[model samples]
Target: MPGKSGEIIDYIKNDLERDPQDIKTIVVTHHHFDHTGILDKLKKITGAKVAIHSADADYISGEKTQHGSLFMIPIVMFMKIIYRSRPVKADILLEDGDQIGDYRVIHTPGHTSGSICLYNPINKVLFVGDNLMYSNDKIEGPRVVHEPENYKKSIEKLRNLDMGVILTGHEQPITSGANNRLDTFLTELYD
Candidate 1:
């Protein structure tokens, strides 16, 4: 989990209440605070195993140094506090093709060097974390907050998938039939 706090757990609890048995595993697209904020708490509450990419296991497990931009300081601090209060450990180390429930984990490294996206082919939904961001009717490349080249590659990788919905990590969700929009945005990045 990202921060492993109580507020995040409440949000998950409400969702679980709506469909208690529907969710099988709690998958962390990456170790970012916003995505993983309630991971450990949710796991304890739901008894569902927590899954994260193996590449990020060390970072999330506090075995490696956490590096990021100035804006990420708060997240790092939050993580430190959470870890101090209640240390968390991932129950499952996920791989590129590992399936969690109906979604497959696609390791789209760029945003965090170990970032991932959960692709559900049946629903044509992708839970992409910082790989792409949507704004003003356009699904564009991620902000130049980290490695721009890797970010561009990740955008291209995600664009090739037959996705109907793009659930980004930081912004509002992008609806179906937006592949062309994403393609154009990625093309602009390449150009």
Candidate 2:
């Protein structure tokens, strides 16, 4: 959903049919340029508090550079050049298990140390970042991983949640029997 600053503002008002003023918080799942590109301007426009996981907060704040991944360099460079991506300070530095609105932050690292998924217990809906992507009507692991062990552990932990719907970073939402599909994937993963 992240795009150029003005594009996001326009999408919020036009496509989503919602006023920008109604946005209370800008929750970034990670510090990838594509995701955080609009954070600064969107926050200013909507006056929304920006939140990011503590592990990745420095990346967005310009306190630390994003390390690891050769594939990211070109994309990052492009975003910087075209979208004018820049660091934006985070108002809330989230930790694992932190609650934001109805969602609980689940720190799912590997793709990035600060990668997280927001889970709404009542709705059984999970918003997974690049750690897990929806593609071809199924869930697939991220294209790049920074920590393999941590990534496996993160996938293992997701099995504990009673999930019914999965809204990943890409593709359409998996709205039915997500738990079974995920468990199947986990079985294949461990086996």
lDDT tens readout by residue for model 1, 65-153: 55677777776776658575333588889887888878888887777767888888899998988777888888766654445556766
Error of 2 at 10 (Å): 2.6
Candidate 2 is scored at a TM of 0.91
lDDT of 2 by residue, 1-191 (tens): 24667777788999999999899998999987767777777888999999999999999898987775687677677667676656798999999999999999999888889999999999899998787877776777887788788988998878888898888776688888788888877777777
Instruction: List pairs with backbone clashes in candidate 1.
Output: 2-36, 3-37
TM-score of each: 0.81, 0.91
Where model 2 places Cα greater than 4 Å from the true spot, the runs are 1-3
TM-score (C-alpha, index-matched) for candidate 1: 0.81
> Which pairs of residues collide in model 2?
none
Q: Each model's C-alpha lDDT?
A: 0.72, 0.84
Q: List the RMSD of every prediction in angstroms.
A: 3.1, 1.9
Top model by TM-score, which number? 2
Model 1 residue 126 CA deviation (Å) reads: 1.2
